[model samples]
Target: MASKVIKIAVPVVIIVLAVVASSALISMRKPPEKKEEQRQSVLVNAETIQTEDLVYKIRSQGTVKPRLETNLSSEVNGRIVEVADNFIEGGFFNEGDLLVRVEQSDYLTNVKAAQASLANAQAALEEEKARGRVAEEEWRSFTDGTAPELGLRRPQLASALATVRSAEAELERANRDLARTEIRAPYAGLVKSRNANLGQFITRGSSVGTIYGTDVAEIRLPLTDNDAGFIQLPDFANDSVKPDVTLTATVSGEVVQWPAKLVRTEGVLDERSRVIYAVAQVQDPYQRNSPDKTPLRFGRFVQAEILGDATTNVIVVPRYLLLAQQQVLVVDKDSQLQFRPVVLERSDERHAYVRSGFLDGDRLAVSAIANPLAGTVVRVSGDTDEQVADDAASEEATALTSQVKE
Candidate 1:
């Protein structure tokens, strides 16, 4: 009992003495001033929002195709005797250039035969006319003022003239067949393929090969019904000029762009894809009309951007600045963060076009933040509008220079 009491008393006494010692130390020092804890500000980059004339572009992709594709066939039957210098696959030919020549021996014989027949008909007609004149003279000597139709030989003369006309028609037909022996190209184009060869016997209307004109290259870009409304397309009815489009594609690890014009739309909407196809045409795709030698070759897949109506009073924000659920982080005038719901018009690869939700001079937070609250205080890395633009420009220039160097 005594030991238990003594142990408890000793601990109690030590605690009391320690408390008194702490109170004395606290009293000896100057009175400490109480202050609230300071908040650790998050550093972020802010961009000043501005409303400008924004052109809402519609993006689409498609493959390039030739404007005109035709299958060349033979119009006359004969043995192929000659071929053009550029008659092979991937060859080029000018208008009226002879592509293939068939043997003309049989056609020439027909023409000669028809000519001989025509000459015989002409000689026979002359003899018949003389006979009719002699008969008319005999009738005049034997009868009085007029003679009977049989005596004048008028029916025979008419029949002879008809025979001459028939012979002439036959000659013209023979001549046409002879001319078709030499097949000529109707237009300047590139041969996609060729099946005919020298000394190959081909029948009339046989398939030769395929070719396509190089005057223009067309790409069919499919757009959704919502996307089509933003672009102006050419009307097939009234023949209105279409909107301009730009196409970009990667070739040999480099991106190349080509200018094209929206020509026409496919008459009906696609049943499966539910898309409206708009056609874009690139003039002189072989660079025949311009100094730029890059050709927008056929069958190249590319992405197209069609120009649309001008959207006034719209803010352009960087795509990374967009937050969850189409929200944007805007810094208020008090330097506090705000998660604002924006009326997102459209979002492309790089920009989020905001129709409403933002005003001029509102600072938009562009830097990354982790689980940021609405009223969280943040430190601005750069305050001025010009400074932000300068920073962005510097970053872009550095990227371009690095890419060029690489």
Candidate 2:
């Protein structure tokens, strides 16, 4: 019984001593030293915003087309006796160049017949005049108060004059028909298609070929309602300056640009699309007048940039920089991020035009930030030189080590 009590008392005394030791240790220890927390700043790219007189450009796309395209047709019925060497598709011709020739043998015969008939009518008219003079003299020799109409032979003379006039008209018609046998180009252009060929008989008003004028090329650029508001179209009522346009296309794997003028607009908007088409004209599109320039060929797809009216003191920024709710991220002088709500006058695929809500010389944050909050610390582009140098040095060391191993 003594041994049992002693063992239990010894264990209880050990537990009590352990507890007192822990209590003393806790009381004697010093509290941890407090240190101010340091916040890390994000690195971003920024630009100094400046207001300027901005000349905006409206972008649209279209296909190049000829200003004048026509279907050449035959004016007289005949078999094609000859076709010009340059009368096929893609052949170029000048004004008055004969493109096709009909068989002229029949037309020549008709012209000769008409000429002979005219000569005969004229000879008959002279004979009738002489007879009338003789009749008038004989009537005067007989008796004279007033000569009778039959005695004067006036009706016969009138009939002869009418026959001569009729013959003259017939001769003119024959000459015109003979001239129509040779088909000539009405303007300087290139052949788009050819229908009638040599030895082919064509009737009057039958299509001979299709031609396109090379003097001017036109592109119909479609514009939305917003785009139209920025562009100033040519005023037909008053003499106003036409807006300038630049057309770009990729030809033969090379990008090319051509200067054009916004000449006119389609009077009505398209019902289905609710868009208006503006015609831009490129002079000497085939390089006929300007041989040094590249030709803007027909049917080539092109993008057009039209110069719009200039606006004063406008700030333009990249479209991507604009955030939700018409806001933009800007960096303040204290290197803090600020979400500024901007008054966006207009925006396109690539750029946004800001009318107000930003002061000149403000630093605009160009680099993207995820879940950005106001008053977040940031380091601007140039302010991170030391960090970039450290990264570059580390990369160089790694490269040297790899080279040594190799």
Candidate 3:
């Protein structure tokens, strides 16, 4: 009986200790704490804006042409009797080189006739002068005063002078016509075509063929109003130093370039397209000045890039960074994206040249975002513009304070 009572009492004591421990644990626990909610910010890639002395360039396209193309004509009427081997199509000739000769028999006869007439007039004039001298001596013996005009044979002398003048004019014309029988090149050029053949009759002003001068090749490049601003074109009325240009064309699956000069712009704008045409010249296109000089063939289409005027304090950035309405998203000083409007001086395939709008040290945001808004919170990869400005100002202040202390 005593052992049973001790077992029951131990069980009761154990139950009481377990209940007390559970109450103490419950009292030790704390209440749940509330947390603050945070919004996610967009991340973007940005670049720092800087000033550069960049050489602006304008691009254009044009066709190469001869500086002067001539329609060769015969100056006198004659039958073609002789032809030069170099006078055929695609032939080259120097200035004053005879390319064709007409039968000279008829022209020679005319020249001789004119010469005989001139000789006769000269002889008559000499005879009249001799007679006047003799008559004047006789008149002077009778009157000791100025002899009468008729006694000095003045009328006969005047008539002879007139005849001489007429004959001389005829002789000059005859010689000129005879010389014209042989067609000679007026300038160094290549024959583009040949129309006259042996035994063919040709008259004055008759078209014989076509030829082009090879001294310099010209190209007319059309530029819009916008493109005109970038280049410094020479004046046609007053000569100026022409800006250098690079001309390129594709030949044999390779691109070749040549140095050209921007000569002048066609003064008048095109009535149809409203575009101004600028002329470019390439000297000695065929006859190279150097061993590596390649010929810019006539009629080949080519692209031209003219070095243009330079402007100070300009910014350059990638094209993707600029947004619609000439606006740009800039990462401002406060770790936020601010929409900015900028002035675009020009844009090419990959870059945009900025003339105005943003200050120096602007952080330009290049990455695109969804539903972007002004003053949007964003994270950037580089130092922000605000921080740079603050740092610079702080350094300036420190420098001033140092000088004061010294």
Q: What TM-score would each prediction reach against the true structure?
A: 0.76, 0.83, 0.77
| Residue 372 Cα positional deviation in candidate 2, in Å, after optimal superposition | 2.4
Q: Which pairs of residues collide in candidate 2?
A: none
lDDT of 1 by residue, 181-297 (tens): 988888888899998999999999998889889888899888887687777777966567678899999888889899999989987899999998888999888776675557788
What are the runs in model 3 whose C-alpha is more than 4 Å off? 1-44, 236-238, 288-292, 332-337, 347-350, 359-362, 368-406
Candidates 1 and 2 compared by lDDT, better number:
2
Q: Model 1 RMSD to the real structure? A: 9.8
TM-score, cand. 3: 0.77
lDDT per model vs. reference = 0.87, 0.91, 0.86
Per-candidate Cα RMSD to the true structure, in Å, reads 9.8, 7.1, 11.0
Better of 1 and 2 by TM-score: 2
Better of 2 and 3 by lDDT: 2
lDDT, candidate 2, 1-406, per-residue tens: 9999999999999999999999999999999999999876898999889877888899999999998899988999999999999999899899899999999998899999999999999999999999999998988898867898888888998999999999999999999999999999989999999999889999999999999999899999998889889988876784366899999998888999999999889878999999999999998889987788788889999999999977888888999998899999999888888888999888999999998997544599988688999999899878688779999999999999999999
User: Number of the top candidate by TM-score?
Assistant: 2
Query: Can you tell me which runs of candidate 1 are displaced by over 4 Å?
Result: 1-39, 127-155, 237-240, 252-254, 289-292, 320-326, 344-346, 359-361, 383-406
